[model samples]
Target: MSRKLAKEISWLLVTIALLTMFSPHTADALTITTTRKLVVLDPGHGGKDTGISSTTGILEKRIVLKLARMTSKLLSDQYRSLLTRTTDTDLSETDRATFANQNKADLFLSLHLHAGKNKGFFFYFDTPDNTPATNETTWKTQGLIHRDKNRQTAELFAKNSQTRNKKVKTHFAPAPVISLEGLQMTAILTEPFTITDIPGTAAEQDAFLAPYAKTLARCIETYFENKF
Candidate 1:
């Protein structure tokens, strides 16, 4: 063989060996390319913030926490779910959004309950700022930028709720609340139902929440599907 041909063959062999050495790293990158979406669920009120309490011994903080837990469990199969507070603890609205932003969540949901005889859901999303973004747009107003996505998610949940319970009233509107303020990711505040009319024992409340949690989880799954 010619010396020139032998030199070319030697260079090709070296290139192949180098690629083989780096192939493991390439495989690792590919494996992590499509990560599961992370969702941050904030159960409203805790600790001294008992929220609404009834003479019957039920508390709003405890009610929402259980809903958050059930929702998180339902989402476990296809996504990463986290709660701002696991146990009864103090967690401010700002702190909840900060937790979601720090974790780079794809979506943030602030769950809540209210005291009313009406059985209905209220979905609130921040109004979109048509004003161009500026230096003033800090985390304090970060939610303004994601207002469109927030509204979309809110509508989705509202539609899903109606589908699950056609008789139940559900509304989605651009009324930003303290619980949904200062979020860097798409966020929604939902008072899924009023506790005043939940009826029956705590165990019956759990039964009511189970199907509702499934609805929440299904909507989240549909969101990620559309996102990707």
Candidate 2:
């Protein structure tokens, strides 16, 4: 691995190591899987629906696209991945979920940047399903089953990222379950950082995003490592 990639993985492993030190039993219980996983990175609000803007005039749509690409690169070694949108084209929420479902992705990560005063990562898993299944079929129940895995994956991300961001004084909320329709596989929505909360010049803003991209990649690695 390149130095940059090593640093990213190191950032995550150090935290995982520390956590294991404190909770060896829990760590011991985790089942590591060697099977390759497929991750779908959904960059939110493309084209006309630019999500949020930065103080330095950066657009949220652009930021997320770059982040998704970076995260995908860091994760390429261990997992097969695809992006929901390659360019600035508007896609509906249902369409995004449908794409992941159609592709049979192992995990769906919907990327977004929140516009707020507080800084840090926030994650949400799919909430309980109220929508009835299309038919009494196995595929219809797939979404419901994936919902549980989504919550587990979200918590893994929260735990790992919270430890990594502690020194930076960043905060992470407890991953909440939220309603998202049309997903047939595990999914999580992530707001890694606030758009307006970024620091430094236009060029320096990328530095702010670098750690986040790596951190998210690490979280994905951690999830697959523990999830068989």
User: Candidate 1 on 1-228: residue-level lDDT in tens?
Assistant: 999999999999999889878799876765664487888989999999988877677888998899999999998466889999999999888789889989989988888887765455555555465444355776666767776777788888898887887666788888747777687788888787877756468799899889778888888888888882
Locate the minimum summed-lDDT window of 10 residues in model 1. Answer: 124-133
- The global C-alpha lDDT for each of the candidates, from Candidate 1 onward, is 0.80, 0.73
lDDT of candidate model 1 versus the reference: 0.80
Model 2 poorest ten-residue lDDT run: 171-180
- Report how far residue 175 has shifted in candidate 1, in Å: 1.6
The TM-score measured for candidate 2 stands at 0.70
Off by over 4 Å in 2: 1-35, 125-143, 167-179, 199-202
Error of 1 at 56 (Å): 1.8
